[model samples]
Target: MKRSRFTEEQIIGILREQEAGVATSEVCRRHGVSSATFYKWKAKFGGMDVSEARRLKALEDENAKLKRMLADAMLDNVALKDLLGKKVVTPAARREAAAHLRSAYEMSERRACRVLGVDRASVRYQAARPGDGVLRDRLKALVQERRRFGYRRLHVLLRREGHAVNRKRVQRLYREEKLSVRRRGGRKRAMGTRRPLETPLGANQRWSLDFVSDQLTDGRRFRTREALSLVVDTSISGQRLARELDKLIARRSRSAVIVSDNGTEMTSRAILERTNRTGVAWHYVAPGRPQQNGFVESFNGRLRDECLNEEVFASTAGARTVIERSRTDYNHVRPSAHGGLTPEAVRLNLAASRLRNVTSCAGRPLPSAQQIGHQTLGLS
Candidate 1:
């Protein structure tokens, strides 16, 4: 059974009687309330005196008014449901529904009336196909290179890249190419999140890793793989450390953390477990966001443009030899915008300048790529 609210005067009277030693049962019966109700009122007024009760009366009245307002609001909602023909008890049925569809066809009343049931005179699709092959290729290239594009964004990009593509055609192309960013319907929540990291500074700081495919002349298709994991100290001009990567990082045990984005090989559980055991921290960048591991992606682009794309491998060993050599050149001669010096030159200077420096780089050292780059009898 539901109980009703007791007024401040009623509470004061009840408390006064109970304090004067009148039995609670006798007082409750006289007041026409249950003993439970009387005790409840006692608890409410037990600590407060008459002055405090008078002071809080306005607050109690305001609370009552607010509760009425809430009930009225709920009633208005129910009345709206009746007015809207939604008497269904299912809350799911009461929920608002919305669907989003965009028609970006380049068509007239004659065409659109065929595609959609609407009259052509009421249509807004373009009449002619914006047949710009060059523009399409450019957009596709940019999308591939950047790995992201939506209709509006692609429109802006095309405009900047000298393509006079309109938003409708861009939308059409985006849908056709499936390049539009996927959208999901839900309430959006605010979350504080970090952005993608760019190139890192400092040796042994960030190493980017990824794999790429290549082919041999004997019709053998294989992946031309690379682990361009360079930890350049950005403070020290983010120098590229080029050398035999195997010699430098291949050894077991005793090092700082090495991070890689998951690319099958990098995601190997063995690598994860081993790193854990060896006390070398391993971090995997989230998938699809290569800029999260920008160094490796940048390195992959260079490897393709400079080495793999330019040459056809005779065999895996020959390919390896060439790749190793190219890496040496990349390390020693190619001035990294991040790393000011060649990998070889940096390593040499590091050894000479600092004590207790160690890398497993040792061999019959070939002539430096720096020497090759600026040759006078193969030396300056």
Candidate 2:
């Protein structure tokens, strides 16, 4: 390294020698500083008194130390312009980051929800769906009364009443409100013998029938079978019956075909004669093959799950009341997967998706839909 032109003591000495009138050359040569360097120092220190120079030097030193500290902090990720709004919640930060990432993978919302540990619904967004409070309330009334409408049928009803709505939005809001005619449930199998029928292709084609049994806290038991009469119309879902065994079709034209297994009540010459008397076709699946009657069995399992299973009924009347309430919910409020549309709405908007395998694409038939006596959601 090159030697410095001036030293602290030498600089002071030079200033002192200049004050004493010593030859500048002798002072410069003694200090090992060239004339130019000497003059530069003189100019710097000459006007400022010694105390000011020292104070300025001290300030410079402090500034250099602060700069080094700041640089080190930057390297270690600690340097920040404003510490405000930093991660107040460490765990929440991780969760929010996961939520943002989940927003990116729109294809797999469940996976994203798992990664984020958030409700799948928080990530599976349906865009702005405005509800006309009055309209929705009215619809809710109808749903409460019917309890088994899919969105398509609801949409038609709504249009007739002058409430224009997007069926898809209705489906989303229906789920968010959990106001569908049916309750939700997990996967399960059926009880007893049944058959699986192909998803229907036309309206008024097929209907499913099943009974829901519940026990009262007093140990009294009651049974009521919901017809779950699905009206298929070249679409997966047509309409739901939720019809109790007591209901009679005063207007026989409402149902064209009835499909069921050889249950005692259904096989009783009485029920068979009833269908024959109504001029409706009756189709029965071979025994032990519930898949042949997939539609109603699915409904039954759901009835058990969302209604019978979600809660414990205290009495026969309580079970009946709860089942009736859930029936209305199932018909009108539930979002469905058969078409990624409610069973009611599948006919108009997502009809294309009907019968296209909601549980999988490989088309594996779901387990026997004949769940009875199990806690289920709707129609069971």
What's the TM-score of every candidate structure? 0.35, 0.39
Report the C-alpha displacement of residue 15, candidate 2, in angstroms.
20
RMSD (CA, angstroms), candidate 1: 24.2
Off by over 4 Å in 1: 1-202, 225-255, 338-340, 347-380
The top-ranked prediction according to lDDT is 2
In order, what lDDT does every prediction score? 0.51, 0.53
Model 1 weakest 10-residue run by lDDT = 371-380
Q: After superposition, how far is residue 349 of candidate 1 from its true place, in Å?
A: 4.4
Q: Per-candidate RMSD vs. true structure?
A: 24.2, 14.5
Q: 34-95, model 1: which lDDT tens digit per residue? A: 98877777777787878888778668778989998897556445434443554433222222
